[model samples]
Target: MRMIEIEKEQENPKMNNLRNFYERALQEFGTSDEDLWLQYIQEELGPWGQPENCGKIHWRAMKFLEGQSAESFTSKHALFQSGRL
Candidate 1:
């Protein structure tokens, strides 16, 4: 546990930069952008995947996506939660 803490305290520079990049990009262009939200969600579902992180992003997305996009994301979320994704 101590080693894990130490490693996290020394986050990889490249990954740190990538996280910063995502923050800036989202701030500038992710508003009402379903595709960008989807991309960020997918990124969160990558190797560093965390359920809470994905949930937060998905909730945020619900505030933006509409019509067909919202429907699609909703269906996808249902499938994912049902283990049919």
Candidate 2:
């Protein structure tokens, strides 16, 4: 997972495009199907996604994501909180 500035959670041009792409991808994959929700969250929290909009992603993921995907996100978040991510 990559690190991103967690201040305010805004967006930029690159982030907008990435968001759009992810939305289309999620739509195609039916959201809960085969996916890369974690990667999306990482990108949203990375350099491309300027201000970081991962909070929304995290909440959505916890609700929609299942199995190992859900567990992975939980673990990553925990590591992040502990500054070990």
Candidate 3:
């Protein structure tokens, strides 16, 4: 456990940078806009041939973005039904 802690401490700077990068990306792209979200993931994560797992992450992000769009649509529909919009 001590060794693991030491290793993590050594890697703390790198981890913090990565976390900040993702935080900025999420702030920019975590939205109901699917196109922007997809573009962000593709540019940040790169092509499908590299780090192949990124492709999966990209697909999952797209799916989640689609779900967000659906939810937005549902909310809009509800508003329309209630004659609120």
Candidate 4:
């Protein structure tokens, strides 16, 4: 008989919030393409193929700048405009 062990999965609250924010932003902007999200993360957020945190940062910023608070940057459209859609 062989014994099997299962590793426990850790839950990150911050990451979960960020993911929720990203999903909301995507739905708000009506962007359903994964490639477009990847491209935006690469170009607007940071360099390509760096690390998970880097990508997360992009998603966070997009969520902040494009989600609901985006109205805050209405005057500074140049900064949050691109992320809006």
Each candidate structure's count of clashing pairs: 0, 0, 0, 0
- Top TM-score hit: 2
Query: lDDT (0-100) at residue 50 of candidate 3?
Result: 34
Superpose all Cα atoms of candidate 4 onto the true structure and report the RMSD in Å to 1 decimal: 12.9
Rate residue 63 of model 2 by lDDT: 79
lDDT of each: 0.62, 0.61, 0.46, 0.40
Per-residue lDDT of 1-85 in model 3, one digit per residue for the tens?
Answer: 2332343355333433443454455555554554443333343443222344445645545455556674664465356447684
Q: Identify the candidate with maximal lDDT.
A: 1
The ten-residue window of minimal lDDT in model 4 covers: 1-10
For residues 30-67, could you state the per-residue lDDT of candidate 4 as single tens digits?
A: 23334334433443343223355544644544564544
What is the alpha-carbon lDDT of model 2 when measured against the actual structure? 0.61
Q: Global lDDT for candidate 4?
A: 0.40
> Cα-based RMSD of the predictions, in order?
8.1, 7.3, 13.5, 12.9
Which of 1 and 3 is ahead in TM-score?
A: 1
81 in model 1: Cα distance from truth in Å? 2.3
Which is superior by lDDT, 1 or 2?
1
Error of 4 at 76 (Å): 26
